[model samples]
Target chain A: MLQQYFGELETGLLSAIRGSDGLVNPRKLYSLEVARLGKRLCSGTSPVAWCGITAPFDLLHSMGVTSSFVEFVGALLAVTGVAGAFIDTADQAGYSSDGCSYHRAVMGAASQGLMPEPAFLVGATNPCSGGLAAIECLARHYSRPLTVLHIPQDESGGNVAYLAQQIRVLAGFVTAHTGLPLDRDRLREAIENTNRTRAAMCEMYALAQRVPSPATSKDLSNFGVVLPLFLGSEAAVELACAYRDEFARRCAASPTTKKRETFRLMWIQNRIQFRQDLEKLLENEYKAVIVVDELNDVTWDEIDPEEPFEGLARRSISIPFNGTMERRVEHLQKLAREYRIDGAVSPCNWGCRQGTGARGLIQAGLEEIGVPVLNLEVDCVDDRKYTEGQVRTRVEAFVEMLHGRSSPWN
Target chain B: MAVPPADFIGFACAYTPLPVIAAAGGAPYRVLPMTESPDQAGRMLHDNICPHVKRILDRAIDRDLPELRGMVFVNSCDAMRRLYDAWRRVDGAAPSVLIDLPPTADESAVAFFAGEIERLARTVESWCGRTIDRSKLSKAVEQHNVLCDRVDALTRRVEAGTLEGGWSRLQAALNLAATTPFDAALKHLDGLLGEAPADRRRASDPPIFLFGNVLPDPDAHALFEACGARIVGEDMCTGSRTFTRIDSDSTEDSCRLLAASLLRRPRCARTFDASDPGRMSQDVLDAVKRSGAKGAICHTVKFCDPYLVRLPLVREALQREGYPLLVLEGDCTLRSMGQHRTRIEAFAEMLR
Candidate 1:
């Protein structure tokens, strides 16, 4: 079913590209790349690995392993509307429904033999504990070797070295499974590609900071976070470059585009993947443009290829979700100031203990900077719990409250 | 010279080293979940967080806990980390230190965790307004080790079906050790052990091995016993995990030894064994084998991701070994646990 879905998506994306007279649609191209990855995973031709969201994809890709985080499959199952069945399978198997739906879906898929069996599993102690647990379960289910990167909360010198050493150990673990040694040149190339992707994404985010923001909420919904799956490849760099050009064009043409820009909002954490109506409702009815996403910013500097492990370690630890709440709030405040957001919307993704766990702190932090926040107590993946009407009412009330405030644009 | 009243340092996770807190001139007070607290933690943290964390936070928000001089938290899992985050916001003036605990027990991780423990020692010393004496720390380690030895002996009795007051008494003693001062807890444990009947053995009840993250409620254990099962052993953070002896070398650095010893314990689900992915399930199997149990029971808290995610494999491992496994999920409440009485009875019946 996954193969067929991705195959159809690849075909549909190809048709859209051809029909557009070969115009480079970054969104379509990005989808095509992901579809190809999905097909490759389903094909089971390459050595695959199931990893946590914060695992160094570049390192894995450099070692000739096809890897994607378990949540990617969870999100895929969710958006494709088959997550409910998988979640039920997991639920019936005694997995708690109170856990993250993303993991539940993946575990269910694994139980149903829907997930591609990987040669090994890599779990990272960042982002969330649920992801690590899911990875461990997958490793146990498939009878595969597992390597866990214990990403530290404090990004001190010793912590960074600890993580870097773990990354090296991870590479060793991968090599033991795949019988492939770590190639220095390939790692260097992968790091270079990652640097290029980061540079383009930084440019894209800069262009998105325009008065009438070029990017739409739909344009970059989960684009920044998911792009890392393709980080070590030329495709990631291309997708990023295309996004930068697209944002640049939109920014240049913004003055006469007749785009409604009443409230420039900041979307916190991940947007809902199973539905499109929320973004449309916020954009069309209220003219509230999501100027930035919490994860869209480039938080780390360029990686030095010579010291790739150290650089990757720093990047992984520097993610807002990995560290203390203060660090996450500080990053959110920076984004709020840069994007000049009127208000922030925190979906407070249900069962997400790491991200939604800090919902109160995030709200308080933003409000401290004179920005109001609307926390939608909704599940991003499990649509079963999402009441659209309630979400619409809350969003509308939030927008109304924002409208009552004095506009900086005026 | 008379010892002054011990300043109480509140902690949540079992990963927080009690000896370090004791050495820093503070009584290690484990803040456990209580059903009496109001549901106010959801306002600060998400409602779907681990019930243990939420209840702890609720206690803090409601000011239902005792006067704590400081707080120590371990970055053991996401829920614990969020609890630390929420605790700081709810009680900003209290001196709190969050130790970055590594999930793996590798050498590098041990070293890193040792540094974190050392950092914790400094912060705790500052909070207590005195430097941590190495001799005092060594003595604390020795005392804790002796306490662990006594608990192990009592645990052997529990496993051999010879424990005097059964699992409830053991759980109560463990809870006392967790919540009270080191000397007082040790004394209580010694008292319990000295009074325990040696020859009387519970032979008819089904011997069941229990495992999960945290099951601090002694009544829950009593419920299992009432349901016609004798809990031979448990691998919970509040039980065996907390009581695992810290083998200390007086010549070695105490913090490093403590870090090593804590990591070496039968790991919580939050800790991963990279070298052996199947070690967690195997650990359960080993415990079950040692206890001579006919069945296994896992009592995990609601919204506890670490245990919830790994439970299927545990069930599979037990099933492969021809052991019936019963998993019970509770919201850190006796009422939630009460709902599982029929199921536990059925499981106990099947084992018999």
Candidate 2:
């Protein structure tokens, strides 16, 4: 299922990379997909186990810190501890929400018996202090070989070279650690499937420009929920096919019960349930559509299958995430205008600086272009902190602003 | 309960102002420890989530923390913001609000802070039903000012060599200051400020910027002092774990104080910029030069995959600038002072 989702979303992912689809809300997209997978895995006959720190290093590169992040971090940490084979990426170097106090605690505790119990620990980085500090601890404590890499927030050349070399080294280390080689064919297959998903997602999303289009945030989040499916195996082909058809059908239809979209919101986040639902509320009640939420369906380039993988490293750094607050804000501001968005929801990812740093600046910039902003704080992956009422109220208030019902929500 | 009440409390944490809740006639239940434990939050979360968040997520998922009236989530870290969102879904216990703070301490930051505080005050009024008369908030600030004065004086004493410091004591002190209400914690913090623990300033101080984690025992600073350099500033959890506040009443004043406090703190990630160290090497070198420090000392927890990456870049950036850094890697929860003593001494001398 995850594989097919990933495949269907592949086209959209590519477009994100090409700067075509829209601003990339990596955290929301990842969360919707991961949660879909988790929900499925949890429903399995056996306890669908998982393990990994649910920090937001990778998400930081795109979304920037959000209002909902604190609750998200606390919730994700609680959930991921008990899950099996959890692989946390947001806590790596350059992935912290801001400087420190990412969501909750800080400074490397994986070794101090911080993570509850996971058979394997996976780590990556792009040179943030907390990330290295944390990963070092995890590597030593879990007794797992670390797959350290230089994750460039800018994806700069100087850093890319270092990261690529490290990735090559990491490929070998992961193979040794998991006894699962970085199979070239498998990787290539994963890329191809991702391509399919992105293309399908792009087509579906494009329909929003049509009058009374059927696509909504829930639909987008659902479509996003299939990321892992597309990124996984051949089985994803089936799910991807369905997703493609579903999205196509939705786009062709007139708007469902979705309320008229008054002010389009470009939501930034790692997790979907909290922020994306705002889109649903906007559409259902206030009548709005988040034409572009970096999280739901952003285009991204496939990992160039080139030797030593140049594009993978490039994409790793450049692909938008909840890390790199400054960059994400810049891209978001640009996208707000490009997408004609009247407002934005900057969902603060807990584990990356990208998520935490720039609510004021982003809001100001967007307002300059007639878009209001609501910096929603919450954890992308942590479920415990999510408050349906609080989130709904805040988003509804923002939607009200979109309708020019009142001043921008405080 | 035995706790005294505060009308408007504050916490240094960027998110989940559990501490503030505790300060404000509520209980600030503890979150996760910065050590080894599978984040239960992550278990419920999707695979491939970051562990930093997992730590907090674990806290949100498992803990009841029902004693608080409400929580103010500070958007300090990105992961934290996300964590707050997920945990917010379970809002039966108490209401949670987001206290958004600007990144820089520029004029714009002050303005934004002013409006934000006003909005927040209104929100607080609605939630607590305690109308925040500006005068009342002013009094609250006044009390905080007293606490800040005590803390500032105590830190000055440490700088003046009038008092000997230890991480445990500092940790307890800051934790208490941040957690306990202003009046209550002031005395506790002041108590530490008065005494010289019968321990003299060692001949050599270990200059370390503990990135985040600090061991509970075997005092790494003491060990470094035994080696050579005097411990200056650090990037650790328990170092100059700064204390200050941002109030709407005195926006500029509060921001100045807050900004200064943040800058002077000994957090390892404090390299001018939050995430980018290489871009700030010159500043790091300049800061060290100004401080007359010889090295950059770091202590990391075992399996801390994130900080390790910073090590490589920090090395590249700082080394090129001719400033040597000594990394003391260890499980912050355990004692690595003994093992790192040798490294500390050698690195300190190497700087010399």
Model 2, range B188-248, lDDT digits (tens) per residue?
9878876754454544554433334434343445555567766555434434333444233
Top of the candidates by TM-score: 1
- Candidate 1's chain A scores what TM-score? 0.98
Backbone clashes for every candidate come to 0, 251
Q: Against the true chain A, what TM-score does chain A of candidate 2 give?
A: 0.63
Give Cα distance to truth, residue A63, candidate 2, Å: 30
Worst 10 residues of 1 chain A by lDDT: A401-410
Docking class of 2: incorrect
Model 2 local distance difference test score: 0.46
In candidate 2, how many Å is residue B176 off? 31
Q: Give DockQ per model, in order.
A: 0.77, 0.06
Instruction: Report the lDDT tens digits of candidate 1 across residue range A96-177.
Output: 8888889999999998999999999988888998888888888888889888888888677588888898899888888888
Candidate maximizing DockQ:
1
